[model samples]
Target: MRTNYEAHDIPYRRKKAAGWPGWNSAEEVHDCIQTLNGLLEPLEVASTADVCEIGCGAGNLTDTLADRGWSVTGVDVSNVAIHWARERCRQQNVTFLRGNICERELFAPASFDLIIDGLCLHCIIGEDRDRVISNLSYWLKPGGRIVVFTMCGEPKGKDRAGYDPKSRCAFSGDIAVRYFAKAEEIIDEFRKESLQCTFQQVVDPPNEQASLRALFEKPR
Candidate 1:
């Protein structure tokens, strides 16, 4: 995963855009920013809110939050990405850290007002998925919410060509790289960790697999 992203110049690209090192059209980048803005608008969260973004590659999404006046922390496992994020986001309210959320504690319990998955959860496979979700719950403040945008259900396109039903994962030459689960299954996983599902949107793009965008809240 690290090698794949390290080669890419930017982290957040429109769904239809070509892979990194390939530039997205101005319109596509605008649409991507709008999508991120749309996710936060409905929540009406305060600007004073503290946010943590997991897998915040290049700080693209983190920049959005910081620009909106929120204090933001961006975490990623890729050192290359972290360096890029820091260079991109120079706002005092923003901080970047390099680490795997699944491997160690990134913050104290009840630490953040919001946690954005940064579209990373789907990349986690096996029991690590459960452990990461559990840890995300642990990091949230009472009544805090998590925004998860991830691939769900069966794979499509090239992903389908390499899908493994038994592991529910998509592969690249025998390496399990991405997991796809039913939307219901994903909701259940968060609920099991005591989070409440507040909103859900499942989208199936043309010639692509489905993606789930949901908001899960920790009970106060």
Candidate 2:
């Protein structure tokens, strides 16, 4: 299935050399891990739990979570990212795989207790996003949680370059990304799926970049 999201095809060497901001510095990586930990804390999960991170670039959070005693699985459509994640994490508790969320059949139903989508959802378009959400909902056990972080088009204006009015998706730049909807729209989507949205927070990046963080749960 050829799709407009072709950012994953960039050569591994280039990605390695470019060293995407999120994966390059330890401090930045630590901050993201800490943020995730803080977000998961309010969910009341057990100490020992299974966690899955969709589009876990280079497995930074996956490795961090595994070290904290959670069994972690990281998935990304980029084989380069998957390879780096596997090699970098190298821990018994962490597993890395290359898969696309649009293809729901790649994953088993009711398999994860916590699913995290860190800046990945926006990359998908119209039906693909819905399919991914439906698949995630189906793959989560009752009472499970799903957390998403993305650049929302609210207080912050839309990313004109990133958005494609025709496809209603983001383009494949050096790293392809899509513009996210307003908080209300996201909440509405969750409601449509009967998912209980628990929290929504706005995060300001170091350089004034902004993002939306949402936590939703499947009713038990």
- The candidate that achieves the highest TM-score relative to the unseen native structure: 1
Lowest-sum lDDT 10-residue window in model 2: 154-163
lDDT of 1: 0.78
Model 2 clash tally, residue pairs: 0
**After superposition, which runs of candidate 2 have C-alpha atoms over 4 Å from their true positions?**
19-27, 154-169, 172-177, 204-207
TM-score of each: 0.85, 0.84
Q: How much lDDT does each candidate structure score?
A: 0.78, 0.73
Encode model 2's per-residue lDDT on 1-220: one tens digit a residue.
Answer: 1354445646544757776533436676776777777887777777677888998878878777788777888988887788787777789988888888778787788888999987777666666767778888988889999998766653234355555555444555533356456657766777687889889987765544467788999999
- Candidate 1 per-residue lDDT, tens place, 1-220, comes to 2113222223343322343321234564465567667778889788899999888877777887899898899988777677767876799999999888886467888889999985678877777778899999999999999998878988887678677788788767666767898999999999999999999999888886688889999999
Task: Report the error of model 2 at residue 35, Å.
Answer: 1.8
Candidate 1 residue pairs that clash: none
